[model samples]
Target: MTTDPQVVALPMGDLTFPADGAIFPGQTVVVVAYAVRHAGGVFLFDTGFREAAPGDDPELREYFQKYALRTRSLPDVLAAAGVDLGEITAVANCHLHFDHSGQNALFPGVPIYVQPAELAAVREPDYTLPEVYDFEGARFEQVAGDHEVAPGIRIFATPGHSPGHQSLVVETPDGPVLLAGQAVYTRGEWAGIPGALVGSSDTRPGADQAGYARSVARLKALNPRRVLFGHDRQGWPD
Candidate 1:
């Protein structure tokens, strides 16, 4: 109900990050989403969380289930934040990973903006639970590159964390805000970790460390007055 060109952050759900050679091995990460009112409607940056039965091997489900420890409906968060489900005009994500896209069912037929590359990537084997991305009545708008999803809301390609990874840039009352998805996974990596963004460029093949570096650095250079992430509980410039 409040229109002030501001971005609001709220808790959507939670997930456990993979401990396999990762910074926060098997650590619990809070799933967060961003919402903003523009042009008489609300737009969601990401759907919080959802868990699904294993698609192929039953064991995969067992492991995946471990990652999705718990969840809360996005609608509840929206309601508490004073957002109307009917007012949501569109949905965009930093990427289509399970934790990020699981709740797409919340807004069936709503134009879900996604990167074409990400869509392609998921189709590959073992990316994630296909049911999460392929749901009934789910609508997707595949974008190839940087494009504005709404007035003052632009989604630009920042493929590093994922081949089709993207980030959101929105102009708010405070200033420009950047929702940097997994490009900057946590506050610790946000401190400085090139490999974390794109993998070890020199030793890793097709890691696209250069691409990830540029994308992460771009978000930093863009110098958003505030920044948010897919997994981090805290945002910068708080």
Candidate 2:
């Protein structure tokens, strides 16, 4: 793996949700966006949530408002980081949650990487908050298994949190850094402790609690040097 790639974490917003049942009171969970500078230009990991104005999707609007989440416009955030939205060559989402894909529209021409199963779920009528399925006008590359999106940056399917959920592993100078996304929400959760996740349903295979545990074990087996969660906290140390 080449050693020059740069990974930058952009703070999109915060959430006050719990990891499992434990009270993570005042947890400043940043929407946790990432950018990778590669020969192809820039690659975005996940698009953080964009706030909805009045009369938008009722369920979505209500969730954001109730949580008091402050979202940064995708274009503005990229500009502030010295990244031009149009220059971004590709985009990849960890999952198709509203909080993760809200800003996908910012890069209309970039191909967004997502799993085939996830795409189907996003289109299902049973899925609530249909806006989460919104792709924001970007092209998509539906991957079925583990593959490299760029040199030194690989994506692995880690289904359970969502059917098509995935995580990224970037070969960094320090070592391999796993962008675990929702696979694990915190260091403790990733450690196999119970009740470490939220917003999961029981219907899907491995969507419930045990699935998280299995995912945690799978990640641990990789022994990554560092693990960054979807929501902000400290990146886990291996």
Best by TM-score: 1
Clashing pairs in 1: 19-25
lDDT of 2: 0.74
Clashes of each: 1, 1
- The sequence of per-residue lDDT tens digits that candidate 2 reaches over residues 1-238 is 5446777777787766543423354554677888887766787889988778675778777766666678888777778888887778888888887778877777666788889988887776544375554645657889987889888888877877777888888887778888888877666566545765443323443365666557667878878988888875567763
- Across residues 134-202, which tens digit of lDDT does each residue of candidate 1 receive? 688988999888898777888978987677888889887777888887777765566654434322232
Off by over 4 Å in 2: 1-3, 17-28, 125-128, 191-206
State candidate 1's TM-score: 0.85
Worst ten in a row by lDDT for model 1: 197-206
Q: Of the candidates shown, which would achieve the greatest lDDT relative to the real structure?
A: 1
- Scored against the true structure, residue 26 in model 1 reaches a CA lDDT of 68
